[model samples]
Target: MAANNITSTHPAFFLLMGIPGLEHLHLWMSIPFCLAYTLALLGNCTLLFIIQADAALHEPMYLFLAMLATIDLVLSSSTLPKMLALFWFKDQEINFYACLVQMFFLHSFSIMESAVLLAMAFDRYVAICKPLHYTTVLTGSLITKIGMAAVARAVTLMTPLPFLLRRFHYCRGPAIAHCYCEHMAVVRLACGDTRFNNIYGIAVAMFIVVLDLLFVILSYIFILREVLQLTSQEARYKAFGTCVSHIGAILAFYTPVVISSVMHRVARRAAPHVHVLFANFYMLFPPMVNPIIYGVKTKQIRERVLGLILRKDV
Candidate 1:
């Protein structure tokens, strides 16, 4: 037990932390966390089901909505289950390979989510700006290709990441600071120089998520310009209304991350729990809120979900 106090020079397995200083609050913390996870699973699943089951929703917008829901599900599952295990069962021991696997899935799916959002922005741009060519621009075949390309891009970018970690010497003990196996968190545990991992990780993240954000911003700029050019107030309102849900999703997906990043800088001296709250939000909030953002904001999805519930009760 005394020897265990010394940090390992080469940790074979990683121990994930729940909420470091707030271990006593882990159970209480898990209530909201479990609720968020459950909602994420149920909401995304329901959105997918609603989108797929309703033949009335076979448009490009709704199809893209389905893609977002799928990405949200994949992204949430990558971290939440393992996180819940840590919080509840206290099963923190993860083999080195498994941690690598989780890291890959988490990063890959996050990139995929960004890519999908970019594709959706393109979908909206083509739809609202060039309605005449909307059908031609975003056919079912094109949508399939976009989905495949997004997945391929993420996989290709992430393939080298785990291998990069394999070369490092993790002198620090197995305990990871966060509930999940984040690229930075895992890399930070390494004793050897990790400049390459740091550089590659930051570069890939910026290239993927940041580039997608830039494109999304450009798309919205074009969208807003197009909406403003509409001849009638009603037309302008209608055009902009279609984009409200997408904007909500964009905000939900990105805000927590930006907030967490800001918190990192501004709250360095703050309590660990403050960081833990943001970290959990960064991981959990988007998936939990995306479906709600889409479902409640998109009239079609909202009506369909309500109709389904009514029919089930009847």
Candidate 2:
């Protein structure tokens, strides 16, 4: 069995590659990375500031948006600094334990973000389908509980990942062939029976993603049905309009992810660069685009952001 090849100790450092065949492009690559990070930070921070400062934005929808911004900040911050270091300074040597820490935060935040999206879907459902219970159902106490539950669920599910990794014997020298310390990327280097690690990773990922996707789809189905039954065209349009930002958020959040996962799992013959490209997009695209999409598509956020620029209270 592959488990028999396990060693007790791992190398002190793992060298991360910016891009294997494209090391020459690392500097160039940092441009987009920097742009994504900057936009993600600036946009998410502005959204957070506007949401928190304006009392009128304190409803369930905005509260979920605030949570989303916080998650984006945490998610992007978890990896971008190290990635920039890798690209700009050729600082490829990541401490082994520190890599585990990075993995924990990255995966936990990802799962947490999915949970938040699911909650947002529920918020939209309540607002559109059961307007009478919208405010009463998503009370402060309920939202707090949802927030706590989301955090707890992510932490609980992801906590075991590092420990599972710790037991593996990584005899495959210090180099990780990608820009960051992703779970499958790191574990693939270990020269042991990685079956358990691979299976558990897939199981955990599918567990979260499937449930999140199912609930999100179900909520929207109910929402669409309700919108159709509304008598007036304007009322239907208004109901659907409220969900545009959420729909954008869902697509922004899931598109790259689904692509990446499909490439990794289904298209095993995909080019190495293809995998890397999707991986980068998976991490960077959602965070950078979510805030901008909300700003452009959600009237309240758009107005508030413009108001801030014009030095007028909204």
lDDT per model vs. reference: 0.85, 0.90
Query: Which candidate should be chosen as best, given lDDT against the real structure?
Result: 2
Residue pairs that clash (backbone atoms under 3 angstroms), model 1: none
> What is the lDDT for 60 in model 2?
95
Question: Could you tally the backbone clashes for each prediction?
Answer: 0, 1
Looking at candidate 2, the ten consecutive residues that score lowest on lDDT are 1-10
Which candidate has the top score in TM-score? 2
Cα RMSD to native, each candidate?
A: 3.7, 2.4
On residues 231-251, what C-alpha lDDT tens digit does candidate 1 reach at each position? Answer: 999999888888888888888
Model 2 Cα lDDT, one tens digit per residue, 112-229: 9999999999999999989998889999999999999999999998899888888777887778888888998899789878998889889988999899999999999999999999
- Cα deviation at 162, candidate 2, in Å, is 1.1
